[model samples]
Target: MKYLIFGSKGQLAQEFINFFEKSSIQYKPLSKEELDVRDLDKVVNVVKEYKPDVIINCSAYNQVDRAQSFPEEAFSVNTLGVSNLGITCKEFKIFLVHYSTDYVFDGTKQDFYTEEDLPNPLNKYGESKLLGEFFIKNTLENYLIFRVSWVYGKGKQNFLYKLNQWAAANSMLKIAVDEFSVPTSTRTIVEITLKALKQGLTGLYHLTNSGYASRYEWSKEYLKLKQVDKLIYPAYQSDFNLPAKRPKWSVMSNQKISKILNTDIPLWNEELKLMVREMDI
Candidate 1:
């Protein structure tokens, strides 16, 4: 099957590329510069030209704080861009695989969120992504939307990278203790996506490492693995003074996915160890 992947330069995109390289899969990767998703005409043209069996859209406006100031750009890229892709894919009968985030839900519920829960986004970024989700679900029949959270891996930009940098340069690092969610690894996400493709699964699913952790807790684990635990300190969200309001509880339950796939997700600590070992941390 010919697979076309957008957002080729991102960490998840790179991981997907690596997975494709090792397998016998035929795939094409495109960066934002190569194909601007915001332009409907260009997006339609690219879809027609590639004629891929599966189209994985990894491109998104991920700047959470900056999105507050540039809501229109965020909505255009995350919502309108996705709408264009979905319409084109629908016309050609291509399987559309899109990634979403747990931020789509407000942190009002104390327990883990299920697929049936209604989305109430708290920030512009979340609102934009939720809008994209609606467009895809309404426009396309052959599609799978995977909602993930707290994604990190050997990426150019991620929480892990920032933690590493802070640990090396500063004597101490303060992280938010109240903000909580399941931290997902890029490798796990790619593997799950590939598995879903193999199984011909099509629907919405929540994908993340088995357990949840606060930003402070997750950072502490990373620091411990790096032998820099002493340098880290926990602080409340109000102390950070961020521009955008984040969900206090973004944990997602993967019971549905596990039942469908007959497999369990790895624990956050186990995946963290694997990541650290793979990166030789």
Candidate 2:
């Protein structure tokens, strides 16, 4: 099967490329500059030209706090771009895989959210992602939408990178204990997504790590792994006073994917350990 991946420069996209390269599948990875999704004409033309069996859209505007100030740009890239991709994929009868966020929910509920839960986004970024989800569901029948939370991995500006940077520069790190979610590793997401593609799975699925943790808890554990004894302070959301409203508890349950694939995903701590080993930090 021929797979065409968008946002080839992203960490998740890179992991997908690595997986595809090792597997028997053939793939064509394209960066944003290579195939600008914002251009509807270019997106349509590319799909028609490649005629790939699968289209994995890893491209997105993922700036949560910045989206508050630039909602239009976020909407243009996340919502409109996804709409164009969905239309093109539907026209070609290709399988579309889209990545969504746990921010789509308001995070009022204490329990872990399932795929059946209704989305009530509180911020602009979440709203834009939800719009993309709506477009894909309504426009394309063969689509797999994976809504993940607190994604961190070998990325340029992810949570882990920020934490490492802070730990390196400062003796003490102040992290939020109020906000909580399962920190998903990009490696796990790539593995599960590849398995789903091989099995031709469709519809919405919640893909996240096995456990949940707050920013403070995750930082504490990560710092310990890094052999740093810096005092990690736990603070509430009110202390930071960010422009965007974050979900208090947006941990997602991966039971649906596990039940379908008959496999178990590693816990967040275990995944983090692997990541730390890879980074040698």
Ten contiguous residues minimizing lDDT sum, candidate 2: 149-158
lDDT for position 28 in model 1: 92
Tens digit per residue, CA lDDT, model 1, 1-281? 99999999988898899888999689999999999788888878887888899999999899999998889988998999999899989888999999999999999998999999999999999999999999999998889999999888767668888778877788878889999999889989998888888899998999888989999989988888877746567789889888879999999998888888888889988998998988653
Across 141-222, the per-residue lDDT of candidate 2 in tens digits comes to: 8999999888876767588788888888998888999999998988999999988877989999999989899999998888
Candidate 2 residues lying further than 4 Å off, grouped into runs, are 279-281
The per-prediction tally of clashing pairs is 0, 0
TM-score, model 2 to reference: 0.97
RMSD of 2: 1.2
Off by over 4 Å in 1: none
